[model samples]
Target: VDGEAKVGWPTPSKKLELYSKTMADWGWPEYAAPAFIRSHIHWEDLDLAAGERVLVPTFRIPTLIHTRSANAKWLNEISHHHPLWIHPEDCEKLGIETNGLVRINTGIGHFVIHAWRTEGIRPGVVAASHHMGRWRLGDDKGRSWGAGKAEIDRDAEGRWHLSRGEQQPYESADPDTGRIWWRDTGVHQNLTFPVQPDPISGMHCWLQKVRVEAAHPGDNYGDVMVDTDKSHQLYKEWLAMTRPGPGPENLRRPLWFARPVKPLATAYVYESGGTTG
Candidate 1:
């Protein structure tokens, strides 16, 4: 039955279309066909130094949700630490041990985490899971299953620092709290990354070209430092890359593109010579 039948896609022409009419009509003919566009952390654009490596920070562990499984005791016990996954070759070249501490420097800040050498990751690239790293300003606040206590402060230069405190066994209504076996809640590396949205997709790009070096003096396992001022500047830089909308017929967005929730047809049309609210 399968050999006798033929099937095609749902779009017009009933086949895969490399050229997109929607993109051409929306004033983006250059992107009508599939093509590679250089990104903020593109390898050629990064020109990484000896110690610098591209960090793929948005990868997720199969067992956990995106930063939401911290409240689950079983999941926390299964995977507690979100260690920096470095390729074995790169780790050896940089003289990094399996459990050695490494500081990853981003555009606006740096995060200190433990390096775990593994062949599962690609050479010259490092990865860290988005799970874990849940923290509360004080020990009394937040859930105890996967969150740790941290002290945050701002210096004279407007730099924010988050220093993690030890997670000690505490007496609570839940007896499991007293049997806590792990001290590390991982490092909150996302706080150090700046917003870098893709121009066309508008999705935040999570990959970053960062310098990975031995942890500096006084650097703790979960240390995270950021400069909000610089982060804001980066936000503007990416925002500037976007092309103005109000395409043909003064439509705010391409009518063919799917949105989370479809709005009224009138909402798609912007006022003459004015942007939509």
Candidate 2:
């Protein structure tokens, strides 16, 4: 350690190494230096139709945290509807006016929501803020930060339809329920999204791309259309990316990565070589 040269960032050298010798030594010279790998969701690759755009799903508003804050009425009031943020230029190109409806089709399913044309977001990208739409089946009489409730129905034909009717003044210890305003409580679009597993980072990617379109007839605000069967199929496809065995590395798990409960060091070696410890 005393003789080791101090290095600053860019890895594998005393100074920033433009060419990573470590990667070259590892037989990946092409990726030894900085490189550009086009994203799978790049606009050029997609066979987009007239109204179709690409979705950028990770954007979030400051008013709320993830899914947990949905029941927080005050926070919901600050930012309620998770409108699909489209660019003004794109709206003109697609004939989609501000606050107009846009149907987003994912690999698994689709959902319809109002579009908000803004310059903050770029064209060719549609972003919906995270976690505004919290719903339960009509039977679950639970109340939360959300201002309204919804009804999800599956007819004999096996098609799923989601709709949120008008919220009536209700009696509750929380007076906020009576004063509850705003009709666009948003839709549960998560069900329509397909799982995207990252090939490089080895993390399950929540931000995914979806194909967008002009809302079809009967598509209303908070209206979501999805095929659960296709969702399962897409899940299977992503799961298929996983290796059959333990891992790419011989170790059970990476030592540095955070785990809720850490196991014995010996267990990390996997003496038995089965799934369990």
Candidate 3:
């Protein structure tokens, strides 16, 4: 029996390897070493004078799942509004008062929402929980638990606009729908966000760099404006940052890596004249 301690990790070195040889052998050599890779919204990339702030959209309320469980009236009542969690300092700097309208301008569009100035959030950074702010175009009471009635329109400039109204009590199969007291269903902020996938990991980056300011005179409480064309352009830009597959061994991806729905071994191989499944 070996006398040495067997408490080491299961890694190749039997200990934490700061320099990952596995990554270097793979397509991502740049990530082989622990390094701080700058994000798309790096601090240096933002213009502080322009009211630019990083939007942390991945925050979630402990009482709610990610936009789910809306049918639970109790949960909806507790975590109803997904307001912009801004620092009081930033609010004062931007002239945004508590519960005041703030327009968050993303690359593709902007969403008008109420601002909650609290020290719980970091300065120069803002957050909006993922729960709530659901909307439906018509009177589809199917998801009426936390969803509000919204009017969607496209302008001549090919920009999409969604204006959500306050949630009103309505007659539904659930008797509780009629007794609904909370009218603030929150604003749909996702519509104004653009898809920013990480190049190396292929994960969606939820932190968005945006301009935060007081709402314009015409901006409504739940107003959302998106330019589909601009969104497409930004998508293409981020797509170009990624490295195409066919990594080591001519495989679409590392065979050891886990996939949601694993296909056949043949499907993982790169076929020059074939399209993705």
- What does candidate 1's lDDT look like per residue over 1-277, in tens digits? 4678666675554668899877787667999999987766677665445687889988988878988877787888888888899988888777788899999999999999999999999877999998878888865768578788998999999899999986667888989888988887788899999998887767888889898888998988999999999999999988888788777788887665557898888887987856532
Cα displacement (angstroms), candidate 3, residue 81, comes to 1.1
- 43-82 per-residue lDDT for model 2 (tens digits): 7876655555667666777888876786777887777778
Q: lDDT per model, in order?
A: 0.84, 0.69, 0.85
- List CA RMSD, all candidates: 3.4, 4.4, 2.9
What candidate 2 gets wrong by more than 4 Å, as runs, is 1-37, 48-50, 155-157, 200-202, 248-250, 259-277
lDDT of 1 at 199: 77
Using TM-score, rank the candidates from best to worst: 3, 1, 2
lDDT value for model 1: 0.84
Preferred candidate (lDDT higher): 2 or 3: 3
Residue 138 lDDT, candidate 3, scale 0-100: 75
Predicted structure 3, TM vs. truth: 0.90
